[model samples]
Target: MKKKFKILIADRNPHVREFLRREMAGPGYRVRLAENGREVLKFIYGDEFVDLLILDPDLPDTDAPALLRKLQNRLPYIPVVLHTFIADLGHCPDIFNVVAVVEKGGSSVERLKTVVYEILAKDRAKEKIRNNMQSAGQKKAAPATGGKDEQK
Candidate 1:
């Protein structure tokens, strides 16, 4: 069986959260919603293993960049897709874990899903390589306990 990816959508608007949850909660994905940056932080800091984060930069109670920085410091492996009104993220600094910046609007939902799929696919590829390497290492490390060499 294929592993399902877990995505966390962090936005202040309930509508946005619901829309994202609905859009991303299909096959091969498990979506989690958070209404604020605080909630996002709570989910990230907790024991739950989130594969990706779709974050709104205009979050209440916490600056998005700060939160992103903190998240990068703690969990750099997880990729982030910044879904916001900010069309251009060129000037923004400290973009460590951000994989894509998607502007919110009419067709942004579809764009978000595409980006999510691509990022998750890349992650899956990496995981496969890692697992294969581990399996190869184990095979090499296995001892020939009862082989012809044991009688020599």
Candidate 2:
């Protein structure tokens, strides 16, 4: 069976967190919510693996830029979708892990969902290719079993 992708949604607004959770959970993703920067850090650094993050740079009680930098350093493999207001986009730190910046609006959830799906699909494709390459390399590295040297 395929593993369900786990997503962490971090926003300062309780309503936004819950709304995103409901939206993402409907499609069978394991959704986790964080209402502040501390909670976001806890979830990301915890034992549970997260496949993606939907982050609002205005998260309370922490420096947003610092958090973004830290996440980029520690979890570069996990893609982050910045869910923030359009005006605040300029203040956001440019980080490698941020795959998309989604403006928050009444109709933005659909776009967020589409972005998440595309990112995960791309990741899956890359993983498949890596696995295939590894298998091929292993087959090539294996010694021939029925050669003249084996008979001797």
Candidate 3:
């Protein structure tokens, strides 16, 4: 069976978290909600893998720079989407894995969904290409039989 994409949505507001959870989960994504920076760390560092992260920089107890630095050091491949107000955008750190930033608004949920889809789709394409290259390398590297009749 194909694996369902796992998304971690980190936000300070309960309503926003629940809203995003319902929206993302409706389309068959495995959604996990984090109300604070601690929960976000827990979910990311735990056993299960997360394919994408939708994060609000205003998460309590930890600042965006610190959290982003940790994420970059540990799991650089896991893409992050910053969902924040327009004012907070200027304060966002220039991190490697943060693929996009969506402004918080009434209609931002749809934009967030679209960004998530695009990032995950690109990830899937890269994975497919890597798998193909690996298989091709393996085929090329296979040991050849040593016999006089064997073609060169």
Worst 10 residues of 2 by lDDT: 88-97
Candidate 1, residue 28: how far the Cα is off, in Å: 1.1
Winner on lDDT between 2 and 3 is 3
Backbone clash pairs for candidate 3 read none
Give one digit per residue, the lDDT tens place, for model 2 in 17-117.
98898888854489988888998888767888799999998888978778887787788799999999978866665655788998999899999999999
58-138: candidate 3 lDDT, tens digit per residue:
888988888998888888899999999968766665656788989999999999999999998888889889989999999
Best by TM-score: 1
Ranked by lDDT, top first: 3, 1, 2
Give the Cα lDDT of each candidate.
Answer: 0.87, 0.86, 0.88
Error (Å) of candidate 1 at residue 71 is 0.2
Q: Count the backbone clashes (under 3 Å) in each candidate.
A: 0, 0, 0
TM-score of each: 0.92, 0.90, 0.88
What would you estimate as the lDDT of candidate 1?
0.87
